[model samples]
Target: MARKPTSPADEVLLAAARARSSTVTATQLERWRGAGLLPRNVTRSLGRGRGSTSAPADGVVDLVVWLAQHARPGRRPHDLALHAFGEGLAVPEPTVRAAWRASVQRVVLSGERDLPAPADGEDRTDWAWDVAERAAANAASVVLPRRMRRIDERLAAAGVSWAPSELTQYDRGPAGEEPVTARDFATFAAAGVLAGAPELTGPAMAPHVRALLPVGAVSPVASWLEYPDEPGRDPAEINDGAGLSLLPIGDVREDLLRVIDEAEPHQLRAAWRAAAEMREWALEHCGAVEAELDAGELGDATLAWMMGAILGLPRLLVRQALLDRRPSISTQVSTAVMVLWIGVSLHRLRRLMPDGQYELLPALLPPFLHPLAGIPLKPVGEAAADDAVG
Candidate 1:
């Protein structure tokens, strides 16, 4: 036989009424529950292994009951009551918790009445908005101009709807390239298309592009950016623009001597593809960098970054190479990170390339010359001084 349907009051109000001696009406119980003073689930279990069944103290239920009993109590400050509720429960649902918490807080914080001191000030909704605005502005400020359409499309494809002001704020920057927003960056990240974007293409680009997402692979462009080079130009001095120079500084028209300084040259075509592969490898396996840089592993510490750069360099080549066709086992994954591990470390110690030479110059060379452009592969002392030089 079918049992009669439980009354609406019985469904929600019965438990509260039973817990409170059934003195309060079901409606009243519901009102308290809606007000968030009542615990959603109250499990009643008999005491175990005892002579008499005594009402046991439940820490969780006691806290809940205490919170509701004092909630919005007459003569109590609104803010005080509100904070009390939060302190009582460890709730996970943010929206529900926040709404109820707000209601209790508002009552405690009402104008002109004093209560117990609050742990923290909570009245600044605008502060949150201000932070969001500034963050969007910073993101927009860095977007590359050439990538405007791509950024727009990526945002759209991701089904992200942003206000014009928000987009403008996020993309706001100098006239050239508009920097990608963090949100948009995350979107491109999810789609796995960050590596294929136009701004990340070519032999040279900014360091942040590679740094944005934790890609499975690195690009040749990234390799070129980190390339080490020959005489008078140290690798660090190239990308960061700081180095002592020995050339004659001058103007061509005048008879005056000119010391023209340049970024350390890295051979792009040759090193980029290989370096990218290493970059991808390192990223994929978190310990790849540490392993390559290990004193015992890849013992010649000078070769670390340069070799690591080779690992990811292929990623750059593959992106362009695969544009026309698909690669079955494209090394465009994290395995390339290893190459960059070697590349960056060696570059750091300024041991990967010929001293006094510009790293950036070699990076500008064609990819076909990759095998030949770099300094000799032999260890520092083993290779002839003149032959070891790039």
Candidate 2:
């Protein structure tokens, strides 16, 4: 059967209707009409002017919902162009804006924006899916925040009630206490897991760090030739040069290389010295990457994420120090840090997705790492190696 052509007035009206109910523009309506997505007679013509044409009420609602579902990110859709037509149903700007926001919330914001729907009846599939996804994500987000806050409060209370500076002096850690070392990279690595991370202490810290001490060297500062000038030291010179050359893992050493790379000559030398000790430590411990990864004691993802986090700090710090007119540090330190971190992240990501596909990383990470975790569409945490490598 042959379909009748839509009148100009109905087209104009449909444009307004779509705009009010969904977010479709008049231009999109015209395109849909031309594409047979809408019935030809769905539009109406009221007057002589170009603005007189409009779309039907039913078509307007349907098209708006369709556009919202398929709208691409980073590009404005054709439906937005309908704001040009001022006549039709006299929908208020604020009301339409609110309705649009609501529609987006119902469709996309709830995270059910990717479900399939049949072309015929029942428009509630996507809408219902969105509500369910949003509810689940919301519940998780709410519960996690409360748990985190309670833990934090309990720790703070314990710290205030039984404050002890050192473990040797204190009997036991407070109830539900987190390691203080995690708050600082050097401390965390040295005290928790890294070999050279713990000894970066006191006024001697800066000087010893500048000297590039060995990762496992006990009393590294005393091993330096410059120590002879200090108060209680004998005139005996030390020669543990090899000990200072090897960087320990988890130290902020590569960050020094970046600083030297980026810093002006005036600050370059000092920043290099500052990184000496850390560099030596990182070189030794972190160098054995393959072995550590194989053991699974070191998570590739966690290491990579931490590397990024650590490097970002130095980038900002160097700039801030330079702005203070202190050119004693290298500006390029952040780059080295970032590269190492990225390497770690990529290594982990590769392991997580052995097949060189994102079927795992994208689906798994958000649910596990994001505050608002969701029920994954696929079993992301399942052993991926069997599927990809096997």
On TM-score, the leading prediction is 1
Point out where model 2 deviates above 4 Å.
1-175, 179-185, 191-331, 348-390
lDDT of 1 by residue, 1-390 (tens): 865564443444445545964444445434545654443444444558543322212343443444445544462332323344334342223332343233323321121132232334242222322333333343433322222223334434443333234233332222224444655543332212211222222222334344332222233334444342244232223332343211111111011101001111232122335544433433333233335434334423223322332334433332233232333212221112223223333444354333635465344332333243443454567656745574
Best by lDDT: 1
RMSD of each: 27.0, 24.7
For model 2, residues 1-390, the per-residue Cα lDDT tens digits are: 754565565556556556666565556556655533344443455667754444354434544454445545543322232221111222223332332233223222333345433353344333433334443443322211232233224333333221223321322212222322212322222221112222322222323222221112122223232233454222111112343222222323333333224433323222223333333333332334334444545445324322222223222222223233322212223322333333333444344334555444443231212111112334555657546864
Over the full model, what C-alpha lDDT does candidate 2 score relative to the true structure?
0.33
Please give each candidate's TM-score: 0.19, 0.16
